[model samples]
Target: MIKKAVIPAAGFGTRFLPATKAVPKEMLPIVDKPNLQYIIEEAINSGIEDIIIVTGRNKKAMEDHFDRSVELELLLEKTNKHELLNTVEQISNLVDIHYVRQKEPLGLGHAILCTKKFIGNEPFAVLLPDDIIDNEEPALKQMVNHYNDVQSSILGVKEVPHNDVDKYGIVEIEKSSTSLYPIKGVVEKPAVDVAPSNLAIVGRYILTPEIFDKLENVKPDAKGEIQLTDAIESLRFDQSIYACALEGTRYDVGDKFGFLQATFDFAMKREELHEPLKKYLKEKLEE
Candidate 1:
């Protein structure tokens, strides 16, 4: 069972622009709760007992979110808002939240390395908040089930257009089966025509702890950053790595357009806003 999960929230959300100037990107709300909260809930529901967040400077908002706010609790206490107080308390009680500082923005590999001590010897899930998945069974839970059954590290896969393969980690298939396929290798941002497959490795991953060592040995790739895909591919010679096409809609909230789309779609899913938001969009469309 994957008991530990790490969420790396140290990146500067440059795509969100002026709004993200002072705010942590993870804290941006899709509609109600912060974006990171969605990922946290998903991890908790997937049976991840411990959540280790790798944060950096100016990311205190991320830390304070998981911690108790004594002042606000007192204010709510005076107001006698019992329900609100309970909701506030729920944040700290949700799960065991641990934090490690990533002092440098070396790469995704560095972010994972920051939590080495906390992960110890167990397999863990790494969920990137940028990729918000909509599924009946949470994406991580689905991956976890696959990992337990196969006893192999798994990557979340989603088919993309051939031209877009260069935008992600493209997989090279070595063996194919009914459901699972062994990857010969993975190339991050390979040129469009040279990509081996259109099945791109998404942000969700169930990785063995041994990835830490592979990450340590990998040299910096094209952009002078240690790409985690490079490390995962390096492990192919010894470890069995598998990919599963995630069973739902995945919104790449990292981009500006995707973020706006997530806000619109997520808001449209709420009982309170669905009809009204749809009507509003339809009216605007007519205009």
Candidate 2:
């Protein structure tokens, strides 16, 4: 059973710009809660017990969110705000949260590699905070449940348009079933003329212990940092890689325009804010 998950949060969200200079991109507000909270909630809902977050410098606010704020709790208790208390308490109740400093802004592969001591010999999960899936079936859980049956490394993949394939890690599928497929190999940002398929690997993975060894020998290719996709490719022959296109609408919050769209959609999901938000957006459109 995949009971552990590692979320890499050390990336410099340059796309978000000056705002992100002080604020961590993962902590950006979605609707009622911060963005990282949603991702953390997803991990907790998926029955993941040990949640490891690989964070870096100036990211102390991320840790503080998970940690208990004693004074704030007492203030809420005094005011008899049961709802607020319950909401604040949910953070602690969610999971056994652990933090490991990535030390430097390496790469996603290095972030996962840092959790070796905590992971030990178990199959762990890696979720990218940038990819937020809106669905009843959590993306990681979907992949892990499938991995439980197959007992092989599984990646959360979704079909993209032919042109957009170059923007992501495109999977070369050997065979295809309904929701799952046997991925032959993956090409990171392949050119349009020589592209394989439209299926792109998203931000979810259930990887075995072999990946750790592969990551150790995996050099920083052309990119200065270790890429996880490279390590994933090296494990191809030894094990089969199954791609599961999860039943969810993925919003790439990392993109500027996508982030704006997500903010509007997520706000519309809120009961109190829906009508008002729509009205305001309509008014703005008219202006």
Candidate 3:
């Protein structure tokens, strides 16, 4: 069984600019909870017990957020805030969380490669926390369950507009069934005319151990960082790779506009924030 998950959280949030100067992007709060927590929760819910978080220099705050807060727990207990206390306590107890420093802002492939010893020849999942997926079933759960059945390296794919295919890694797949497709190959952000299909690879992956060998020899791009797409393409030469079309709305929270959309969408779904947010939106529209 795929019992472990690796989260690559070492990136410098250059997109968010000055705000991210002091904070890790993964630590940014979507509402009340840090974004990384949601990803951890998703992994735990998908039956993944061990989690390896690849972090970097200024990500100490992210670590602290998941650690036990004795002082805060005492204060909440003394105030008789049982619900809030339970919430805070659950953060640390969620899974067997471990941290490894990526040491540099190499790339997603390098961040994942750092966890090789931890993974130790086992199939594992990699989740990019920046992609917040809203679905009836957790996105990773769908992919994990699919992986369990197929026993192959699987990627989470979602159909994108033809024009937008250039913005993501596009998968050339052969449909095996209605929901699953075998990824023959993948092209990272190909030109519109060159893209094989509009099915874009997203942030979730169930990767096999053989990927580490490909990553070790994967050539770096002009930016001198090993791209995960390159390694995956190489891994395709040896093993079967499947792409499962995701049944959910994905928010690329790494982008400002996508972040705002996710915030508004999630907030509107909450009973406490729904009416107020709706009323505020109506007022703004009228103005």
* Cα lDDT of model 1 by residue, 88-206, tens digit: 99987899999999988898988998899999988999999899998989988888888888888888888899989988988877656544667778888889888888999888999
TM-score of each: 0.95, 0.96, 0.97
TM-score of 3: 0.97
Off by over 4 Å in 1: 174-178
Which 10 consecutive positions of candidate 2 have the poorest summed lDDT?
173-182
Which tens-of-lDDT digit does each residue in 1-287 have in candidate 2?
Answer: 98999999988899998988988999888866778888888888888988999988778888888888888899999999979998898786678888999988778889999999989988888889998988998888888788878999998998888989889988888666567788889888899888888888888899998899999988896668888889999988789888888888888998887777788888888899999988998999999
User: TM-score of the candidate numbered 2?
Assistant: 0.96
Q: Model 1, residue 194: displacement in angstroms?
A: 0.8
Error of 1 at 109 (Å): 0.8
Question: Scored by CA lDDT, what does every candidate get?
Answer: 0.88, 0.87, 0.90
**Residue 128 shift from truth in candidate 1, angstroms:** 0.8
Local accuracy of candidate 3 as per-residue lDDT tens digits, 1-287 = 98999999988999998989999988888877777887888888889999999988888998888899999999999999999999999887888889999987778889999999999999999999889888878999999888878899999999888999989989999967568898889998999998999999889999999999988999988888988999999998888899999998999999999888888888888899999998999999999
RMSD of model 2 against the true structure: 1.3
Residue 101 lDDT (model 2): 91
The candidates, ranked best first by lDDT, are 3, 1, 2
